[model samples]
Target: MAILIYTQNYDGKFKKSVFELVTYGAAVAKELGTEVTAVTTGKLDTETLKELGKYGAEKIITITNEELNDFSAQAYAYAIEQVAKKINADLIIFGNNPYGRAIAPRLSVKLNAGLAAGVTALPSSVSPFTVKKRVFSGKAFADVVIKSETKIITLNQNSYKVEENPVDISTEEFTAEIPEGAYAVKPIETVKSSGKMSVTDAEILVSGGRGLKGPENWGMIEEMAEILGAGTSCSRPVSDLDWRPHEEHVGQTGKVVAPNLYIAIGISGAIQHLAGVNGSKVMVVINTDPEAPFFEAADYGIIGDAFEVVPKLNEAFKKFKAEN
Candidate 1:
């Protein structure tokens, strides 16, 4: 039996989350007294694939099917299922991102394996595989037990620390036999954001709410994000009003993020909003209302006008950066 990790790449390059998944998979393999085999698809060089070995992938397999150039959940799931069967993988792992969310359920059904998504830790017991995960929008925790012989799990982003445990690695190329209908729904075009840190990947985020007043005033928010080397985000209402793109929205119905630091300007903390960002390590709220709900959830709060507070805070950050 082997542990298999599905490492997703963007534009033929692996991201930090891929390394984290590999590291987590390696730890799980050690726990189960097995070895880890990572699988991916796309046109990536051998040197680029070798990096997975630094985090405990004993072998890396790349699916070189030209039809898989664009992501289709059904096609990707079928490819991974084939790989798992070929390697006799008992435990399959994926990062709890969009790809994992879409593909894990289908793969689980196809493999007839029990699945646990948003897993936050390693199995407490191998005899009856159990995992802890956040539920109720990060407001509570649940320990789920998977009883299937072959199991699948999607690890929550940033929940497990990334560690290096090097091992000698080998690579292989597999071309999956995808049927004709697999590409029933193919992407016609893909537009990628250029020269900006993705909110989901950012360690630090400067997010604005309706308190920023208007889209015209977003220059200060952009300035703050640039000064801090952080990503810019906005609340649901701000996005709804077209002050920012919907992609920048974060909340219950928007993107869920767990950054190291999240700065909220002019946002009153609603439960829906908090549910999405409460995973942040540290939250700072700056608002004019002393009783703003965000203050209750913030690690630090400044009860003053954002217009006055933001400029001063930006200057302070600049000074701090210059000095140190």
Candidate 2:
């Protein structure tokens, strides 16, 4: 009745963010005494689209335009603005990803709506609309109220537990014709990372930094992560020197991830990096220097040389899993 959620289909498949945002939008809609509508942009799998119904999107609206195949910020914003107005949707939500960040603001400007980026918690109903969001890199938070008729928000990734429902759902195809727009931005070379799970999307992450001593030692990092069924990432400097793929880099100016378990090997935690990973559920820091900054923020901290320590840790973990 009141809200809309814009879902970005990655490679025609829904992401964790899609399920999470839809669940959250549904909850808010329930509270507001309104139903939530989910809008999808670009090509999508029919089977995957059918799954979104369980998340409580009363109806699903999908827009298919080849122009939107590769994210053109202007085109996406234009399409969403058209869809929202067509439905007269008052509240719109998006996941706080690179694409979301680029498009939400543009849509906000076009719709003349109030937007809150990096929202952490669901909005608490207090007469007028108010949302709680992280400020100052999770050090603080603020509750913002949007009095505008239209409200736009980008929910923080991995903040909400994914809720699954097994039920039949309805899908509606939206035939909103695209309008010609000024092409201000040109398509650049799309350089994609080679792996499946990035640190942000990984269930478990094994990370390293300068503590590895050199890129030559990164093999140990890879070996351990491979053995444990985890992805690999590094601090900003590691990516700077090309020791790791840019997509695997974690921290401010990089990807922010909140995986179930995060293992930091031989990396000193800087405030910038911690800001990105503070959302991780469990963090284990392995470092030779006892005073390495990461220990202070870790759930478990080990002061030992990573070269000697990591092999022992892996062996112990293997044995425990075997025995159990």
Candidate 3:
């Protein structure tokens, strides 16, 4: 059994999913008594290649080039194809990030493999590999069995933990001729979040909804988030109204997050909204509506006006900090 992983080098840093994908791929390779190889191409320092070993990759087939700066769906698809062909890979895993979203479908078509996105668990069975993924916007789940000759799975971020310590992996540079084609779409702008902790990386997340009243009142939420060292997220409507960037929008139309603790203020737990945040380990719902659906999923619920409740909570947190 041959295994390969596709990873993106973001400003010389591997995306978080790189660890999960590599760890899973390495396990599959170990079970099959095969080599676990990582395939990545981008503008990255050579030192980053050696970092793959911690995730259990035996070798990294990397393409280091500055021309690979901007994303080219064609270039990425072509490069991964080369690695798949050379490695004779039976399985390929990606982090399921935005870039992976663009490449996985193309790779699946090119490799003639079964594709499953938003996967949470590792493969239950590899031979005729089957995967489990969220469906109906996480209202339910379905297990899919791929009988295809090759297997490709994209792991969702925050779904699996990367091994904290891994053996250092050796990397080998593999070059490929980039396919010649004009990109249909190129990104002219990338607006990143300015939060203290990105939602995915945050252990605590504080979010607000329509109850925020207006963007002018958002200061309370932001101040609390800053004190807690947590990330800030908004309801879908809040972002759609331009109060927040689309990336900070946490819902069916935006990012899905599962942090250690999720504190939603003034947010009514609509089914669509819950779909994105249901994975959180601990949920705290602070809503004026006692009948809000989010309470069912929350570990704690405070039915009160967010304006008053949040200020009191902030004062308590501050006093406790001062005492400690």
Cα lDDT tens digits for candidate 2, 200-294: 77778999988887888888788778777899989999999998778888997788888889999988999999988888899999999888899
lDDT of each: 0.92, 0.84, 0.81
Better of 1 and 2 by lDDT: 1
lDDT of 1 by residue, 167-209 (tens): 9999999999888888789688878776588889988999999
TM-score on alpha carbons, each prediction: 0.96, 0.93, 0.91
Ranking by lDDT: 1, 2, 3
lDDT per residue, candidate 3, 1-324, as tens digits? 788888776677975667778877777777778878888876556567667777788788778655566788877787788889988888888876777788889989998888898788877877658788888878888898988888888887777777754765777787776656725568798776563466666768889898888889888888888778788998998998888767678888778888878899988989889998998889999999999999998899999999899999988878887788
Candidates 1 and 3, the one with greater lDDT: 1
Q: Specify the highest-TM-score model's number.
A: 1
Worst 10 residues of 3 by lDDT: 176-185
Give model 3 RMSD, 1 decimal.
2.4
Residue pairs in candidate 3 whose N, alpha carbon or C atoms collide under 3 angstroms: 53-169
